[model samples]
Target: MPLDEESPVAQVRKNRSWEYAPFVNYGNGMGGDRSNYHFLSLGVEAGKVLTPTIHAGILSGQFQLAVNVMPFWQAYTPAPHTQTFVFQGVTYDEPVGGGTYTGASLTPVIFRWNFLTHSKRVQPWFQGAGGLIYTSHKFPPDVLVPHGTPGGTSVWNFSPQGGIGVHYFTRPRRSIDLGVNAVHISSASLGDHNPGVNASIQVQVGYTFWK
Candidate 1:
């Protein structure tokens, strides 16, 4: 037997659709050590819906696998300056790293859960994602490097993040999206020193095409 065309279950069926979204995100550094930093990025997200509507009461939804690539990523930090530090019982004045850092970012793995709503115009989702970043210069400037010395942090870092958002359909197969994400950045000991950005809160806006 064929699925009833008017059945409620047929309304949210999305077993094998592709989604493409172009978005922009802006963020500010948070936590103890990264308060002064600012971030901006532009990217596109591509995904394929892999599951049918699962009727699990409130958690009824579809699963999606996505990837985001941001070709233009930038971080703004305080200008270069000097500070005081104590290393191994000796107190010394060291320089802090600061300035505009340019980079590219790619999130190759994004696990998303799209919740079902009776309304045809709205859909909500939550996702957990991991990504890699490559900067033109070392990131999250070191706090204890002397003036003539270099090499503290790494140019490569990893970002693990989670977010929730909603999509509002404006027309057939087109929608607008808004989301907020909590992101953590770290070098994971890839460098001699790891002055990672502990936390950041980012806001994203995008236009999505459902195909």
Candidate 2:
């Protein structure tokens, strides 16, 4: 049948030169309310086809050498610590907005080798990303350091991540993704404080615009 040959995931696999995906991710490990980390992004991708088709292998399917430039990034991380203390006649109280680490980021690049599967309806892939992020304030210390780090958090940090995700197609060249990613934020010891926020798991949902 024509539908069998021109499947949605197949069209996605054939989109070798350029593509786009706008995604959102939500993360909360310990509690339901006090800890919710989220981000919204638009990924601009470019790649070349590894082959016309890959039917069988350790990773069987359409393999692409893909690179994504996430130009727009908005992140939210709610902190869990709010303790007050005074030293040398100076009072320090963790602010309320410290729990709401809201900020914007631009262009965190990711290089990905995608192993799209043979199934017409579904495709699974694994990827890793390393980039830098700049935040507005030095608050929301790493969870391990609930009392806040010495000199507070850095305005700039490095992000390293790895994750797995699957695409489910609803029509030709169109799909939604369910993915899990692990993200880390740290200063790379370049700043006054290097304590980082490590969210072991982040869940993401997204849509692909294939070309």
Best candidate, TM-score-wise?
A: 1
Poorly placed runs, candidate 2 (over 4 Å): 3-5, 15-17, 29-56, 62-97, 142-152
How far out, in Å, is residue 18 in model 2?
A: 2.7
Please give the CA lDDT of all the candidate structures. 0.84, 0.61
lDDT of 1 by residue, 1-211 (tens): 3332332223334435677999999999996657888999999999888888778999988888999999999999888788777789999886777888999999999999988777667788999999999998888778645453236788899999999998877765677999999999999989888878889999999998877
All candidates' TM-scores?
A: 0.88, 0.69
User: What TM-score would candidate 1 get against the native?
Assistant: 0.88
Pairs in clash, predicted candidate 1: none
Could you give me the TM-score of model 2 versus the true structure? 0.69
- State which candidate has the highest lDDT: 1
- Residue pairs clashing in model 2 are 79-99
